[model samples]
Target: MANATSGMAVNDDCKLKFLELKAKRTYRFIVFKIDETVKEVIVEKLGEPTQSYEDFTASLPSDECRYAIFDFDFVTEENCQKSKIFFIAWSPDTSRVRSKMLYASSKDRFKRELDGIQVELQATDPTEMGLDVIRSRAA
Candidate 1:
């Protein structure tokens, strides 16, 4: 159902894919885009389980806003392997203001549909969502 306040609808594929990633490690990340003409958010890309963070970063456009989730895996100081789901709000500086505003307004509604996210990151530039930063947060 689309929320009355934002008129943003999260596609069922988004949740189904997220569940596969969170529970089965079937994907490395998922990229979401808002289709204003449809007034709905849809899956733009599904990163393969073998995809690297660099590949995930490359999936994002230089001058557009996107919502994505990365299955971040890391080892703790004690050498325990673990993973965390990262919800990223990507609004690049070069993106149009109108597109940014729409994504910003609809992010919360869309994120709420994905239940397993453990980390939330809002990045205007790549540096802000660097691996080191994600690693530190995972630690």
Candidate 2:
């Protein structure tokens, strides 16, 4: 569904892929991009279940705005393994202003379409969403 506030639509594939990730653990992460010409949010990349966090990080462009969801697994201080679904808004400083604005505005609506997100993070650089930060949040 598209939201008038953001002037962007979330493709059905976005939600479908999210469900697949959340329910089946089929993906380690999913990156979403707003297709300017289409005025809609679409799946730009899917990280394989076996992909590492570094691989997911590499999939993002340095000068672009993207939405990503990562299935982060970590061990708690109590020695229990747990996973948290992280919803990340990637808005690099080098990205186009228009792109950044559109993504920032559209993110919430797009995120709302996907259920079961346990953590929400907005990052302008890699360090902001680093493994350490994710681990802390998962804790």
Candidate 3:
């Protein structure tokens, strides 16, 4: 998820470890931090985080700046079909580490798809998020 504020869509082509954006001079990658607990929660809450490879590729981004897609593949599927009934811890020590770090799930609301991973966290728009601004002329 790229928390995009404008009408930008990820190019539906190309498959690489990372995505490069030329327009805004940025780059993104599909990174995954395997958490058995988080995976289980996803399957229960969002219904199976794993999607068909075809579907995943269809939402990929081309070598353009418009947008990029981060595809996260599951190396293990032990909790793929299970629900939150299990003693799963989503955040784990991951949350205690830092608060500013933005991961895949953190950007879900802004992101369009569920399978892709967002290696680079998008910049937060001040106006959109609603924050007071005070500007002063140079003394």
Provide C-alpha RMSD values for all models, in order.
0.7, 0.8, 19.8
Q: Which regions of candidate 2 deviate over 4 angstroms?
A: none
Clash count list over all predictions: 0, 0, 1
Model 2 sits at a Cα RMSD from the real structure of 0.8
Candidate 2 similarity to native, TM-score: 0.97
Q: What is the lDDT of residue 72 in candidate 3?
A: 30
lDDT of 1 at 78: 92
**C-alpha local distance difference test of each model:** 0.93, 0.93, 0.25
lDDT of 2: 0.93
For 1-139, candidate 1 gives per-residue lDDT tens digits of 9888778898899999999999999999999999888888999999999999999999999899999999998988898999999999999999999898889889888999999899999999999999998998877
Task: Report the C-alpha displacement of residue 135, candidate 1, in angstroms.
Answer: 0.7
Candidate 3 stretches greater than 4 Å from native: 4-31, 34-89, 94-96, 99-101, 115-139
